[model samples]
Target: MQSIRDRLEIILSRLANRADEKVYTKLYSEAARAAADAADARQKAGVGLGLLDGAIVSIKDLFDVAGEPTAAGSLMLASAAPASRDAAVVRRLRQAGAVILGKTNMTEFAFTAIGDNLHYGTPGNAVDASLIPGGSSSGAAVAVAEGSSAISIGSDTGGSVRIPASLNGVVGFKPTARRVPLAGAFPLSMTLDSIGPLARSVTECALADAVMAGEDSAFLQPIALAGLRVGIPRGVLFDETQAEVASAFEGSIRKLEQSGARVADLAVDDLIAEMRAATKRGTIASMEGAEVHEDWLAAGASVPVDPHVSGPLSRALAIPASVYIRTIRRRTELAASMDERLASVDVLALPTTPMVAPSIAAMTGDEALRDKTEGLLLRNTQAANQFDLCAISLPMPGMILPAGLMLVARRGHDRHLLGIAAAVETLLGR
Candidate 1:
């Protein structure tokens, strides 16, 4: 088999001019070549390597790579000082022998769930060219979906990682927030931010998560659906799912049941209520993002901001400080609720995105459509962040367009979540 780096070069050459906007920035060919050479050399040395050794991984532009300026999909940072060191997670990946392919585009400052970035350009949806490839980890998913890399690294403050992974038909994992370090990565919400992997398979995501968390990948047991308890929350998460998405999610559940997993309906009324109330008040993402970017905005750096990206982010900043404070308190309360409520179940399953991928035309420029799309995109996945739970978005089988069946676990139960996800993946045969 060709090394991941060799495959990436072929994919890059094939896609170089096919779509003008799918990828906004790319590393110099020489840099990629050198990484590829080093990977091959290390393999030939007969040294046991890390999980990602020789794997080509694409990163969202928000991560700081030494000598390269962190753009976060905003042109405003084009002239900012180049980073002198890699983000902690990036350093870890490099130490594990993963090749840094290039930085992928994202929603400006990782603010919006919609992947449309006007400055760096939106990554075209691989399954359907006209549809939106959910953001802000847009290009990260695109890189994997289009086979440009074996996996992509993206941050999920509130479903940024999972939304795109769902829409693009890949696996996305968001470990419990505190389990993965966030140092050196650009912040969206310091409290909610998590670095996770987007890969072709759930097992691959598990491997990546192990590397990020500095855990032993060998200890992650394969999932066995037999006798496992799966919960279906009986509220808002199911309220607005599109027919296709609903059917796919339901079908996946039925398959799991048939494969010996015991599925039950559970009420998370209070959690849903808190999430609704929190949305009205603005989320941790919006509040913390405003705090982090305050200085940049004060310096009149808005001109280079992508209208599609900043338009939504600017609205987030409009939220009152009082509301933000209350929301943070509520987030803690909800986290406590999740710990108690999910104590009995192995995993809570839901549709990763409430709706399927929307048309790119529908997501761009129109404020109402943008808001609607953003809300729908992050609806199911955001609860994981709100409650400080670990979650994974696994691609459901038989969907023409990518849709994820999300599995969420209780706080600090990262390993258990991976086990459940692995079992679910086995049951689903994907």
Candidate 2:
């Protein structure tokens, strides 16, 4: 095997060759070199950290690295005070001996689904420059896809990690919201935000997740496909889905059935509708996000924030506290309903996004289209967050532009979901 230092150097060389300043907000060249060297020395001495030792990992910009201000993909926080300590997850990653590659770009405040960042140039889709990388985890996905980092950590509130992972053709795993501690990360929604890892394969994601969650990095044992029960929620999730994406999803289902997995329609439209109704004033994300940025929202135009992020957030300020409280209570009840509903099925499957990545130009040029596209992109994946479940998005087989086949399981069933994803990935020959 190549030495850790050797691998890190190659990645550093690649970063040096490209104008990747927008993709990676910072590059810990000297620090990474030192970490790599330490790992190599430990290997020579027959002592090493756990599974993630020597792994090249990149964290989302929202994570606080000691002594640096967490910008979170906006100019507003660029001048904020430096963090006194590393984010919780960052500290955990370092403890596992993972070499930090530095911070990747994200959507402003991690509020938007599409990956456009006017302050830091959007990191184009990994496969096609014209298309979006999908965000708010845009740079995390791009860094993994471009081989700059073996694993990129991202924050997923509503499909931030999965959307970018799908568009960029990689694996992204979002554990239950509370599984990994959230301290030191710039907040979008305290209730909804989850920190997850995006990587080239499900196993890699599992390893990173285990390390960050402070669990033992046990090797994932792929669940046998033959008796696995898979649920396909076939209602609103399919609406306005591009032909290619829909076709790919069907093909994956058929493949799974042929492999002896049982597939059946699971109606979740009503449950989702009720959840949406409860949050009609605004999503839990928007309401909580607005509260987090109340000072900035009050500053209005003086703040010079992304309007896409600030608009809905500002509107959410009008949402009465009674409504916010009601929405939270209703969401809790609905989440219980969803969990009970999911008990009959081993996992719920769907397209990570209703459609594949649209061109960055088209998304940026048309406001209405962008809004519509954002809804479509977040539709299928957001349910996992709202319902307090674990989910993984695996790149589908044989797509010119990438799409994802997402599998969601009950809350705290993260390990099971990763095992199932590994099984599906194997079946799909990924």
Candidate 3:
């Protein structure tokens, strides 16, 4: 069998041109080499290696590393001081023996769902160069899909990780909020922000989540599909999706039934509408982001913000403080309602992105297309954030490009969600 390092080197060579868009700001060749050396030494010494030993992992630019600047995809922070120490999650990954491959690009300050960074060129979708890779975890998904890294860490506030995974044909897993630590990482929305992984398979994502969240990896056992009750939201979620997405989702539902899983259609329209209304004023992300960047804004340093990222972020900051406060309270109510409604189901299913990836030209030039793309990207995934649910996006088979099937479970049930996702992946034969 080929060693992990050899596999990584091959992938890097194949996907190097994809990096022309600056999806990765730096490459950690030295760290990767060092990891390979250690793995070889452990093998020779007859010592047991960790699950991710010698595996190459990519980091989103938003996370701090001892010597690198956490640019968060903005020229505004180009001159920012280097981090004195690794972020908490970085340290954890290092301890698990995973190599730090490099920092991947992202939407500036993680402000938008559509990945188009003006400062650092936008990361193109792996499936189609003309389409977007989705944000703010754009490059993280690209790194995994293009095979530059086995897995990549990404922060998801409102679908950042899952959106790109859906667009790029990879697996993105977002644990329940607060399951993973947020310290030493750039803040988007403290209330909804979560650190997770993007990888090629559901199993790989689950392994990364286990290490990052300090959970037991043994919990990811094979699960039976029979009797697994899955809820399908009947209202806006189904109505709002495009024809292609609707057809693909229906086909997936049929496959689950063939595998002997029980599927039921449930209505959560009121909760979905309430959540959308809550976001109109401002989300926890917008409120927290304004506070985090207040110093930069006050010092007149926000001028160089990436236009693609800044437009949405500026609008978020413009929300009234009273509205922001009301949104937070409403979020709590929404989470409670979701918990009660989904108590009996093992998981809830939806289309990860209501529409497939749009052309990069259309996204950047047309405001209407951009808005539609962003809304579609977040429509299904945002509910997970609002309800503090654990969710994962797995690529749906038989799609022209990459489209995703999102699986959501109750908050704090990360382990259970992973098992169900594993079974679903088996049913899809991917």
Candidate 4:
């Protein structure tokens, strides 16, 4: 209780005094302080709520906070009326006694992983102010990286959480699509959207995920590194991957091997190619995302959605409904093939992002360059959502550009995945 109160005070001070415009879109100052005080009282009365009691956390703007408009980093919804109820995740977190500091800024409509929202202003990477912070969960990751919160709850549709965490050198976990409730989170791709956490370590993520899932926060049990089977699936995921990310990932693998883990160079290229082909050159998020926003975009709301964002959503309108259905059916059939391919391996390991953070200046205002860069950033992490797998990105040491080594497991293996990640975090720190 005391430790939590101390951290809350520091975070409050930082949020209050910091001059960074992009760090947060809103801060629940009075509510957060009151929550902290109540938690302290519970501790004094010997009636704690749960493990996260008094823990300071941040929510993405897209999550419903009763009576507050879910701007979702968009100008379109900026003046919309407040929500009638709290998002399910928000309620669960509150039940577990979390102190939500405020809603952080994000990519408008959670559209791009590039993290630029000309309307709300994207967060600058904590590692490098000039570079772009990975998004649509940009500010959520930044809050933790910049010391405004201990944990952040964000939605991952196409590497939103992990991409930002990777670029900012923090741990981001995307649980299986079904693990966390998404009832009140604004949808990007309802089928692919999953809620998760970004924090300094896997242990913290494990605890936060549990709370989000309505479970008691428990300490993560570290798995044995020796004899752990790790697979690296071959595909377009590696094409154009930066040497910096490649070197760091490869080096991390060697360390794991030395610690007795079995690293397999798997031949899953055909599986990956078939899956990508099934989607017919466009992403699932693009198709589903268009349906969610087309009505509003057509109504002339004066939204600040960038060309990069509007282009894809507009293009998705042309996709035949049959195309989406056929693609989904094909992907569903291919899930068995993916399952068979991974049956032998305990987990898959890869770079969280194909490249390090690119300067905002380089991609900003250049539509072609932004499109190319966005694809590169989302290339690796997007696979997790498509394949319905639980994934996590752990910060890899020894790099000028921030790098993250991502670990993936079969869907519904979230707990096991976190345990493995905790073990890897320990080994990497060694």
TM-score of predicted structure 1: 0.94
lDDT of 4 by residue, 379-429 (tens): 888888888889999999888979799999988888989999999999899
Note the Cα lDDT for every prediction shown. 0.82, 0.91, 0.84, 0.87
The residue-by-residue lDDT of candidate 3 on 172-258, one tens digit each, is 999999888888898888898999999988888888888888765545877798988999987787656878878888999999988
Point out where model 1 deviates above 4 Å.
1-5, 17-21, 307-322
Q: Candidate 3: lDDT of 118? A: 83
Give per-model CA RMSD: 2.0, 1.1, 1.9, 1.6
Worst 10 residues of 2 by lDDT: 296-305
lDDT of 1 at 269: 74
Pick by lDDT: 3 or 4, better one:
4
Q: Cα lDDT of model 1 overall?
A: 0.82
Tens-place lDDT per residue, model 2, 143-240, is 99989999999999999999999999999999999899999988988888999999999989999999889997557977999989999999988888
Q: How close is candidate 3 to the true structure, as a TM-score?
A: 0.95
How far is 368's C-alpha from truth in model 2 (Å)? Answer: 0.8
Candidate No. with top TM-score: 2
| Clashes per candidate (backbone, < 3 Å) | 1, 0, 0, 0
List the candidates ranked by TM-score, beginning with the highest: 2, 4, 3, 1
Where is model 1 poorest over a 10-residue stretch in terms of lDDT?
306-315
Models sorted by lDDT, best on top:
2, 4, 3, 1
> Weakest 10 consecutive residues, lDDT, candidate 3?
12-21
